[model samples]
Target: MPDSSAERPRRIVARREGPMLVEGPVEIVLEDGTTVSSDRFCVALCTCRRSRIFPWCDTSHRRHSPAARPAADH
Candidate 1:
């Protein structure tokens, strides 16, 4: 069994084929110099680059494919 207490809290969870989940203290900056900062404990960042939210994930990958989840490799 895995130890729950040993689990490390991730500041960000970037999916392989899907949106990236960011647990805040995260700062998102756009290419046009616009930025969105979040104090929330969790957020989804778009990996497919098709989200209307831009740097944020809006679960748009689900429309592209069913395997919509982040992976550990870049």
Candidate 2:
């Protein structure tokens, strides 16, 4: 078993109106039940599921904001 502890804390920067910028070493779990560990310098995660990448943000929030958009439109 691998020790899954926060060795190097990744910085999660939440934009006031967009995706969170995750920088540094981190682990990622996909909805499909797969886990990936990476030391990638940066990753953008969606607060909204508008990303074609699903969990990761491709900057789709630039086009629309879930908080501002009407629920019926979703």
- Number of the top TM-score candidate: 1
- In candidate 1, residue 8 scores what lDDT? 71
Clashing pairs in model 1, backbone N/Cα/C closer than 3 A: 15-70, 16-70, 16-71, 44-57, 45-57, 46-56, 46-57
Q: lDDT for each of the candidates? A: 0.72, 0.75
Tens-place lDDT digits, model 2, residues 1-74: 23548454557898888888887466778879998665768877788788897567788887786676767955
- Clashes by residue pair, model 2: none
lDDT of 2: 0.75
| Least well predicted 10-residue stretch by lDDT in candidate 1 | 1-10
Poorly placed runs, candidate 2 (over 4 Å): 1-8, 66-74
RMSD of each: 10.7, 5.7
Q: After superposition, how far is residue 40 of candidate 1 from its true place, in Å?
A: 0.9
lDDT agreement of model 1 with the native: 0.72
What's the true lDDT of residue 23 in model 2?
A: 79
TM-score of each: 0.64, 0.63
